[model samples]
Target: MGNKEQTFQKIIEIAYVMFAENGFEKTSLAMIATEVGISKPAIYYYFQSKDQLIAYIFDELYKEIQQDIAVDYKELTSANFKEKLLELGYKSIEAQGKDPYFNKIFNQYVLLAARDESYKSQLVELETSFLTSFVEVLQWGVRLGVLDDTPHIEAKAQMLALVYDNIGNFMLTGNQLNYRAIWKEAVHSVIQGGKDDK
Candidate 1:
């Protein structure tokens, strides 16, 4: 790429490492610039502010995670949610484990989003997109007669996502537990129960 694009990418790379190490609050633009071998103004040429930089880093990273676990929407019509969701849980865990440092930045964004309305909106939008996809999968399972038809599919989807997320958080912290067993139990509980039940 050109110098401008190169510099911008370099900024993101260094900033991610710093944020992972020192956190968003402790990381500074000057520090990123120093590590990137650029001036503070140079960093500004690509980002308007520290928040913008952090936001950009998070957006790009989140997109990467999404791509890592991306499901083929066409495959959602299959009647095997038990296997599909189990695979999804495994992929979710892998996504978090792929970049051990991402959770740090993710938690930082959670706190910042709580206090900042703009950040909160962005975070909510990101979560909504993720949740919608998950809900679609569960709904498809219902249509295929593989999973119980629940009117509250959205809530069940959110719960399943949280289960995977919690397991991922544990893995991030080096928690020593039977993650596979726990993940299987949790996924089964969410999808095992139907409109046509006996």
Candidate 2:
């Protein structure tokens, strides 16, 4: 990468660490600049404000997650649909676990969203995209005859998303529950529409 691109990425990486460690309110542009060994004005050259930098951070993080758990719906077969979904759930959990600060940073952003309209809008857009992807997966299942064509598909996807969100919340709170087991149960429940007797 060019020097400019490298410097830009360095600023972002430093800001991410500072935000995760010191929090959004506590971490300032000067601090990030100091950590990046750049002038404070240099940060402004890339990001108009700390809010813009954080929003960029969140946008990049979401894109990384989407790429990590992406499923090729067209490649799925009825026989492998459940397995693929289970793998997706596993990957989501694994990704969160891979970054010890991710859940903390995510929760911080959620709190930031409550007081900032721009953050709230960005979060809403990210969540909507996530839910839309889940719905698309469910639609693919229906098309493949793996899932029943039901009117509540969107609601079911929301429930599954909630499960994943709660799992992150639980982990962030130092909960010792078996998250994988919970995830498996949630996946099966959503797949069966809560009618799974097995």
Taken over the whole model, the C-alpha lDDT of each candidate is 0.77, 0.83
Off by over 4 Å in 1: 65-70, 77-80, 151-155, 191-198
lDDT of 1 by residue, 65-148 (tens): 677556775665544557767877776666666777878778888888889998899888877777777787778777777777
How well does each candidate superpose onto the true structure, as a TM-score?
0.82, 0.83
Candidate 1: Cα lDDT at 76: 59
Candidate 1 has a TM-score of 0.82
Colliding pairs, model 2: none
Name the top TM-score candidate. 2
Please, what are the lDDT tens digits per residue for candidate 2 over residues 1-198?
998999998998888878988899999999999999989988899999998898899889878867865678777997778777878777777777777788888888889889989889988988887878788888888898877888988888888878877888877777788888888897897677433322
- For candidate 1, the per-residue lDDT at 160 reads 77
- In Å, residue 106's CA in model 1 sits off its true spot by 0.8
Worst 10 residues of 1 by lDDT: 189-198
